[model samples]
Target: MRLALAQLEIESAAVEDNRERAEAAVAEAADRGADLVALPEIFNVGYFAFDAYQRAAEPVEGPTLSRIADAAREHGIGVLAGSIVEDLAETESVETPADEGLANTSVLFDRDGRRLAVYRKHHLFGYESAEARMLVPGESLGVAEFEGATVGMTTCYDLRFPELYRDIAAEGADLILVPSAWPYPRVEHWQLLPRARAVENQLFVAAINGSGEFDDAELLGRSTVYDPWGTTLAGTGDDPDLVVTDVDLDRVAAVREEFPAWRDRRL
Candidate 1:
């Protein structure tokens, strides 16, 4: 499949403008013949725009995602609609006792504008951030099928947890999409973890991150795609980019069979 990494340059609290930017990027990706387009995390309100979280939070079926779903249908391409600060109450399915707080949620839209899966971020960052205190941690894992690949979704901080990836892998996922808002000074970690997960699991990994600076932090926009062999297929610098590349879904099984790493795993 040909994938487009929409490394958006998110603006702080500029919801309407950022939505427009993402729409245009989706169009560009379609024009470039990408079968699927994955966006950066929190591209709508900017990840570090902590104050805007409460105000910008919307329901799962809110206008922001509706617009993106329309774009995906119009372009006849599947889309990983980055992520949004979601008011869980808006989507009754996600509501829980912690519905009093918000959830960092990601949605997947098929080419026909169908909502396939919704994944709230499982790991909330606690290192000098309000996420842990403000948002409810997600409790479930989500996986779907797209273009002959079993796809799964995860957010930025979740990449640091191998058990989560292993769970998805055990469920027969071949390609995992990570929407991120990774910041500067941790570029090495950003580069290392995704490739490590891909090589160890023998599955394709696509990590899409945002660009631009917020009041409290700056994003490192190295959106990347790694093959099952841990080879870097496509990557961007620290800037807004549409990193597009093709990946063979068949390679996942080939690599797993040839490497035998999965066969060596022990409890």
Candidate 2:
């Protein structure tokens, strides 16, 4: 399937401007005849824009996701919407809760406007700041069939965890999609981690990240796609641009057949 990765710049807390940018990028991806279009993590509201979550967070059926579904249906292309703040009303409190705070959520939609799955970020980054304090970590990773391939879904922080990828791989996922808002200094990790996961798991990895600086942290937008052989098929350099690549799903089968590393694993 032909995937268009929108590696674009996002201004922290500016939802309107970011939405315009994302819309344009999706349109551009459609123009290129891409079967699936993916965006970076929290492109609507910048990742460092922590304060915006309360205001920017909306339900999965709300504007942000609704717009994406419409776009996917309109253009006849599947969409891998990057992370957004999802308000969970299902788990609301009586005293102070209209809804439980925020979840770093990635929503996928098929060309027919069907909600494929919702994968919230299971690993919330709390090593530095207090992401766990505000954001609710997702319960599980999600896999869905889209664009003729079984795609495993993960968010930014989840990329650092190899077990998550391995679990998905064991579930027969051929391609992995990671929507991230990785910051600078860790730029190398953002680039290297995904490739390493691809190599180890023997699956195609498609990582999408946001560009531009936000607050005190700058997002190093080096969105990348790696083949099953760990080849860098496409990569960007901390800039706002789209990386388009055609990924042949059959390669996953071919590589696993030749190497047979996954099958030989004892543990």
Candidate 3:
């Protein structure tokens, strides 16, 4: 499968501009022959825009994801609408983690514009940030079958927890997509975690981050895709880019059979 990771240039509280760029990227990715394209976390309302979270919040099937689904159908490519600030109170289509608060949520759309999965961020960032206190945590894992492969979804801070990836791997997931809004000074952690998860889980892990700066933070955009063997198939520097690469779905099973590391897990 050909996957595209769009490292978008996000502006704090600039909902219209951000959504426009994201849709353009989707069209470009599809034109580039990508079967699926994934966006970064909170691509509409920048991650560091804490004050704007409540104002920019929308339901799971709000305008943001609705436009994304339309773009996917128009381009005839699957899309992971990276994530949006979800107004759980207004969200009635899906089971929300909370009823009165906001949550970091992502939605996946098929080529035909059908909703496939909804993944609220399980691990909310708490270190020097307002994320944990501002949003409700997701209770369920997001996994779905798409294009002959089982795909799993996780958000930025979730990369620090390997147990989540292990659980998804145990669910027979072939590829994991991480929609992140990682910032500077943690570049090493951003680089290390995804590769480790891919190698250990024997599956593809694509870490998609955003670009541009906020008032108190700057998103370090080194979007990347790692194969089952922990090899970097395609990656970009800390800038706005669309990283695309072909991944063999069969490689997941083949590598697991050859390495047998995952099979040896006793605990």
Q: Judged by lDDT, which candidate is best? A: 3
Q: Write down the lDDT of every candidate, Cα atoms only.
A: 0.91, 0.85, 0.95
Structure candidate 2, residue pairs in collision: none
Kindly list the per-residue Cα lDDT of model 2 for residues 19-115, writing each as its tens digit: 8888888889989988998998888988888888888887888888778888888888898988788888632321222246678888888997788
Best-to-worst ranking by lDDT:
3, 1, 2
Residue 6 in candidate 1, Cα distance off native in Å: 0.1
Candidate 3 total steric clashes: 0
Candidate 1 vs 3: which has more TM-score: 3
Better of 2 and 3 by TM-score: 3
Which is the better candidate, 1 or 2, if ranked by TM-score? 1
| Candidates sorted on TM-score, descending | 3, 1, 2
Q: List the candidate 1 regions with Cα displacement exceeding 4 Å.
A: 93-98
Query: What C-alpha lDDT does candidate 2 achieve relative to the native structure?
Result: 0.85
Error of 2 at 148 (Å): 2.4
Q: How many residue pairs clash in each candidate?
A: 0, 0, 0
